[model samples]
Target: MTNYELNMKYYFAPLEGITSYTYRNVHHELFPGLDAYFAPFIQPKQTHVLETREKKDIDPVNNSGITLVPQIMANTADNFLWAAQELAARGYDTVNLNLGCPRATIVTRHKGSGMLADLDTLERFLDDIYNGVANNGPKISLKTRIGKDDANCAQKLISLYNKYPLPELIIHPRTQKDMYTGTPRWDVLEDCLRISKHAICLNGNIFSPADHQELTARFPTEKYPNIKAMMLGRGLIADPVLHREITQNRPVTQSELKRYHDTLFKAWDALNYGTSTLLHRTSELWFYLGCMFKDADKYVHKIRKAKNIPTYQAAVEQLFEHCEPGGYFSAP
Candidate 1:
């Protein structure tokens, strides 16, 4: 690997309801190479107050050992400013705005990619944020899709983003309509690298070390040097050691993976309210983790089907007992 590739910063993208503080803590503990970890979006209310979950997620004490950047999902400038100040008071120096979430529920509220529908309004919103919050408190970063309905919007948003002095901009190369479907528009990213003034971190379809290597090769370091950061979400969860593998050349061993799984399971078991919640959490994680096991179909079905904790435990045990370790899917 080139020194440029080794030096590139790596961030773990926030996955709402999935990359909570607990998960971040454990992921960091088990695999300790990510430069920064972004917490899932904190949905600020009209009252300028944070929800209980939001408060806990961004609380410094909860994320003591890691560099945590709180992400805010809000269309109101007032709410965004308030949340930014509140998090700043909590010792956070950077906050990311969530403008890329493609879920129907979020966009319908005109908060995420929905804002992309009206670039003028988005421009105004960003104007307010840069003038109000970003100037006064922590540096603000943005995570956004290309547009609400089409990839062309991504091309346009690049010009819009270049207008701001944003420290970092993470672009997931799919429009809202794509919704994790189809191929990510690499053309849009290639264009973004050439046009964006801020550092552009590519986020999408990065699921393995090979994927990372291939992507960096596409945009040679000598040319697109501004594209210096990469964010991995589902891929990191699927193979916890992926960042370590790419940056440190550490291969993930089966026993190590099992230990990481066991540690996360025990942590969730302790904090989660009931067996059902615990099962739900672990099952969702296993959905990606199952990819690392050979013949994953054999036990993955059982892991997904398990109804209770004991049943889930048995299924997991059976997986480690029988299945060999290899990987399943390459993307989330």
Candidate 2:
């Protein structure tokens, strides 16, 4: 049940509204297991101006000493290239393109996974990226789902991806239709690993160290050696000490959780997000952290009902002081 001895590379999947500079910096300081942390996708405009929020997320001052990669979500190669040039000028050596987002709002716009439905267009887009600026600017990596409709579509995508000099192709093993439901289609991913010319990283259903073990075993070093990296998001949020457990070979301590939570809380409080706004954000975090408690439902409810910062803090304290940590809650 332990894959502690395996030398696996780790990446923190960018969860929008959650894994921003604040979360990334704190997590990086607390747990040093991750090789890189991806910033949530920044949608660049035709003007090619990085938004204030996007600029802040990639600010060297904010992300100092953290191996952070900024992700750009653009359907067009022009928009993508413009943003890539901007990022590279900002000193980012690598930038990730988001082709994996499944939200209806994003997909309906013919972006994210929706673009995967058209091979001709997607190829042209990639061609523009590589031929135009990718050769001269920051090396671009991709985060994609298998396809927009059928998981089998990954096979064709891989054939197309093989034509490019991509450093890595991170696959989530799910079609857009699947969203976050069901299990990942590892069968399709296995085929992807077999034919992909580039290195591949698995990025789905890795909720625990054992889950990662199962994935590594299936794609063992003896056979599928190209698959070595895994991206974690909800799993890390659900158990903030997960990286420590996986990389440091340690157990999740209450003290560790307290420190992590308090760090995040104090940081958010500094933003002066207003009492209700701050409470809402903190409560949302507890929605994942609460999963580790024995009576998760009760603790989660109390955290949700909390009206102010003090009440929220009190509810969290109650969970840590009275409730034991161990449950079967999985991130959605």
TM-score of each: 0.97, 0.95
The candidate that achieves the highest lDDT relative to the unseen native structure: 1
At residue 132, what lDDT does model 2 achieve?
Answer: 74
lDDT at position 48, candidate 2: 78
What's the lDDT of the predicted structure labeled candidate 2? Answer: 0.83
For every candidate, C-alpha RMSD to the true structure in Å: 1.3, 1.8
**Candidate 2 residue lDDT tens string, 152-218:** 6789999999998888889999999999888899999889999987877789877776776687678
Spell out the clash pairs found in candidate 1: 291-328
RMSD of 1: 1.3
Tens-place lDDT per residue, model 1, 244-323, is 88887777888988998999988888895798788788888888889988887879889888898788889999999998
TM-score of candidate 2 against the unseen true structure: 0.95
